[model samples]
Target chain A: MKLYDLELSGNCYKVRLFAALAKIDLEIVPVDFLDGAHKREPVISLNPWGELPVLVDGEVILRDSQAILVYLARRYAGQAWWPEGAAQQGEVMQWLSVASNEVQHGPNAVRLVDKFGYEIDKPQAMRLTDRILGLLESHLSSHDWLALGRPTIADMAVFPYVALCHEGGVDLSPYQALDQWFNRIKGLDHYISMPGL
Target chain B: MKLYDLELSGNCYKVRLFAALAKIDLEIVPVDFLDGAHKREPVISLNPWGELPVLVDGEVILRDSQAILVYLARRYAGQAWWPEGAAQQGEVMQWLSVASNEVQHGPNAVRLVDKFGYEIDKPQAMRLTDRILGLLESHLSSHDWLALGRPTIADMAVFPYVALCHEGGVDLSPYQALDQWFNRIKGLDHYISMPGL
Candidate 1:
C-alpha cells in the first residue's frame, strides 16, 4: 500500500502508527503542504480534501486519518488493533469521532497555528484544549485503552497530537491517567515515529 | 436501540438511515438541539461532547453518529448495509470519512446556514461545495455506491447533505452521474425519512 503523507502532521501520523500496529508495511510518499504540494493535481487526485495520509491500496484510495484507521483495522481483522463485536466496534468509532472533533480542533489546530506561524487564536484554542483534556481525563480514569479494553486504532488516531499537546501550549499535566494511558498505548508492539523526513 | 437525534441534522439522519437499512427498529428519541436538551445533564452525561445522534443500546451509549453506524453494521453483520470483506470495508470507511469532512463541512454546513437563517459566507462555502461535489462526481463515474457496487452505511452517512445541497444554493447540475447515484441510494428498500417529531 502507498500512504501519501506529511512529515510533521499528527493526522498523517495516525495512519503511520496504525500501519505499524497492524504490521502493514506501506510505501510513504511525502507531500509538502508548505510548498503547496497538496494543492497540486497529482496529490488532489488521491484525496480531494487537500489533506495528507491518503492510503492507496491497489485500486482503493482512502482519505481522512480516522477513516484510514477504521479501514486498516477492518482490513486486518482478527488483529488486536480492530476488535470484532458490536460494543467494542462502537467504542472504537466513538473515540474516532472524538479524535476528529476534539483532538483535531484542539491541540492539533494549535499545532497548525504554530507550525504555519499564523496568528495564534490563543483563547479559543485554549478553551478547546481544556474541553478535550477534561474528557480524556475522565475516560482514562478507568480504562487503559480507548476501546474494547485493548489498544485500538481509535487510540492511535487520537494519541500523537494529544501526547504532544504541550508543544501546542496545552499542558496535559492535570490528566495523569491520560498520561499513563498514553504510555500504555505507546508501549504496544512495533511502534513508529510520526513521519518526519 | 434508541437513537437520540435532531430531525434536521444530516449527521443524525445518517445514523437513522443506517439503522433503517440494517432493518433495525431503533427507537427514536428526539433531542431538541436548539432547546438545549442535548446540553441537559442526562444526554451530556452519556456524551461529554454533548453532540446529537447518540445511540444507546443497553450499556453502550455511543456518542457519534458515525459510531452509531459502526454499531448497527457490526450488530447486524448478516446484512449488505455494510460490506462483508476487507477491500470493500476500506471503501466503507473512506466514504464515512468523506461524510465527516466534505459532506459535513460542505452541504451540511450550508443547510445549517439556511436552516438557522445565518448570513452565509457564500464564497468560502462555495469553494467547499465545489471541491466536494467535484470529488463526488469523479468517484461516481466509476462506482455504483461508496463501496463494493452496493448501498451501505457509507452512502447513508453521506447522502442527506449531498441530496439537499440546493438549500444552501449549491447547484448540483455539474455532477450528473452523482445525481443519479444519489437517487439510487435514497430509493433503497428499507429507507426511512429523518424523524419528524
Candidate 2:
C-alpha cells in the first residue's frame, strides 16, 4: 500500500502512527506540502480535496485520516482495532467523529495558526481547545483508553494533534490524566513519534 | 429505540430520515431546544456534548449523527446501508467525516447563525460552503451516489444540512447535480422530511 504522506502534518501522522502501531508496512510517499505539491497533479488527482495522507491499495484509493484508519484496521489489522459488532463500532466511532470535527477545529486549528502561519480565528480555536481538553481530561481521568477498553484506532485518530498541542502554545501540564494517557500510548509496543509529538 | 430530537436540527434529522428510509422504529422524544432542554438533564446525561439526536437503543447509547447512522445501519438496516468490506466502509467513511466536519462547519454553521441567532463567522462559513459545494457538485455530476455505486448512509449524513441550505442564505440553484441528488434521496423507498428541508 502507498500512503501519500507529509511528516510534519498531524493528519498524515494519524495514519502513519496507526500503521506503525499495527506493524502494517506502508510505502510512505512524502508530499512536498510547503511547495504546494499536495494541490498539484498526483496528490490532487488521487484526492480532489487537495489533502495529505491519501492511501492507495491497488484498486482502492481513500482520503481522510479517519477513513484510512478504518480501511487499514478492517483489512489488515484485524477486528481488534476496528471491531465487527455494531455497538462496539459506534462506541469507537463517536471518538472518530470527535477526532475529525472537534479535535480538528480545536487543537489542530490552533496549531495551524500558531505553527504554520495559517490565518484562523485564534480565540475561537482556543475556546474549542479548552472545551475539548477539559472533556478529554474528564474522560481520561476515569477511562484508560478512548474505546473498547484497549488501544484502538480511536486513540490513534485523536492522539496526534492533542500530543502536538504545545506547538500551538496550549499547555498540556494542566491535564494530568491526558499526560498519563499520553505516557500509556507512548509505552505501547511499536509506538512511533512525529516531530511536534 | 429512542431518539432525543429537535425537529429543526439537521443533525437529529439525519437519524430520523435514516430510520424512516430503513423502516427502523424510533420513539422520537422532542426536546425543547428554544428553552435549553438539550443542555440540561437526560440529553446532557446521555451525551456530555450537549448535542441533539442522542440515540438510546436499549443499553447502547450513542452521540454524533454519523455514529448513530453507522450503528443503525450495521445493527438493524443490514449491510446495504453500511457495507461490510474494508474499502467500501472507507469510501463511505470519508463522506461521514465530510458530514461531521465540512458540512457542519459550512451550511449548518451558517444556518445556526442566520436562523437560530448564533454568533459565528458567516464569511468563513460561506467560504467553506462554496468549496464543499463545488466539490459535491463535481463529484455528483458523474456518480449517482456518494459511495459503493448506490445510496448509503454517506448520502444521508450529508443530505440534511445541504437540503436546508436556503435557510442559511445559500443559493443551491447553480449546483444542478446536487439538486438531482437531493431528488434521488427524496425518491427513496420511505423518504421523510423535516421543517426547513
Best-matching candidate per TM-score: 2
Q: List the residue pairs that clash in candidate 1.
A: none
Error at B69, model 1, angstroms = 1.3
Q: Per-candidate DockQ versus the true complex?
A: 0.45, 0.85
Candidate 1 per-residue lDDT over residues A158-177, each given as its tens digit: 89888877776666777899
Error of 1 at B46 (Å): 3.1
Q: Where does candidate 2 clash, by residue pair?
A: none
> Each candidate: fraction of true contacts kept?
0.60, 0.71
- What TM-score results for chain B in every one of the models? 0.90, 0.99
User: How does model 2 score on DockQ?
Assistant: 0.85
TM-score of each: 0.85, 0.99
**What lDDT would candidate 1 get against the real structure?**
0.76
Q: Residue A145 error for model 1, in Å?
A: 1.7
Model 2 chain A poorest ten-residue lDDT run: A119-128
